[model samples]
Target: MMILALLGVLALAVGGCVCVVWAERGGPRWVRVVATITLAAGKVVQYSAKNRRRGLGGSNSADD
Candidate 1:
């Protein structure tokens, strides 16, 4: 069951990557929307990690 769930998530991630590439090449409207969402999600994850590091007393030299 866990393997199946992991595979499902992997499939979604692959699909999102394909959508991102397709959108960059001027694919359909829906693809563009998906790509935008995927990018935004990546940014959110990045931001969350950064903040988490700061909360844990990471290096203060890192730029915001």
Candidate 2:
């Protein structure tokens, strides 16, 4: 079951990447929308991780 879930995620990631490339080449409107949303979501997750890492150094205290 876990392997199947992993495969599903892999397939989605691959498909999203393909869609991104296709959108860059002037693909359909829906593909462009999907690619843009996927890219934005990825950026949000990336920034969230960066913020979490930055706070890990005990610098999040209110003792400014």
Candidate 3:
């Protein structure tokens, strides 16, 4: 069901966060790999959000 899919995504996000922390402390090669992937995913999300915001008029003020 949809709830199960959402739970799985949340689990992966948490695991990736753990890997990022472990990698920063010089963990094993696999942890480092996962951390790199996690970072890339974060960058992609940030870039997508920025683009979406720009498309929406690039304004953060409410008194527009």
Candidate 4:
């Protein structure tokens, strides 16, 4: 089950990449929408990882 879930995630990532490329070439409206969603998701994941790393440093304050 875990393997299947991982595969699903991989597929989605690949599809999003494809959509981004297609949107760059002005493929279609749906492609642009998908690309936007994909980019937003990537930003969210990046910020989440940064926050997790900061939390791991044992500092709750953002001054660090």
Give the top-scoring candidate (lDDT): 3
Q: Whole-model Cα lDDT per candidate?
A: 0.91, 0.88, 0.95, 0.94
lDDT of 1 by residue, 1-64 (tens): 9999999989988999999999999999999999999999889999999999887664556543
* Alpha-carbon TM-score of each model against the true structure: 0.81, 0.79, 0.87, 0.87
For model 2, the superposed segments whose C-alpha errors exceed 4 Å read 59-64
Better of 2 and 3 by TM-score: 3
Query: Which pairs of residues clash in candidate 2, taking residues 3 or more apart in a chain or in different chains?
Result: none
Candidate 3 Cα deviation (angstroms), residue 42 = 0.3
Query: Which should have the higher lDDT, number 1 or number 2?
Result: 1
- Greater lDDT among 2 and 3 belongs to 3
- Candidate 4 on 1-64: residue-level lDDT in tens? 9999999999999999999999999979999999999999999999999989888776746456
TM-score of model number 4: 0.87
Candidate order by decreasing lDDT: 3, 4, 1, 2
**Predicted candidate 3 versus true structure: per-residue lDDT over 15-40, tens digit per residue:** 99999999999999999999999999
The sequence of per-residue lDDT tens digits that candidate 2 reaches over residues 1-64 is: 9999999988988888888999999999999998998799789989999989878755756445
Which residue ranges in model 1 land beyond 4 Å of their true spot? Answer: 58-64
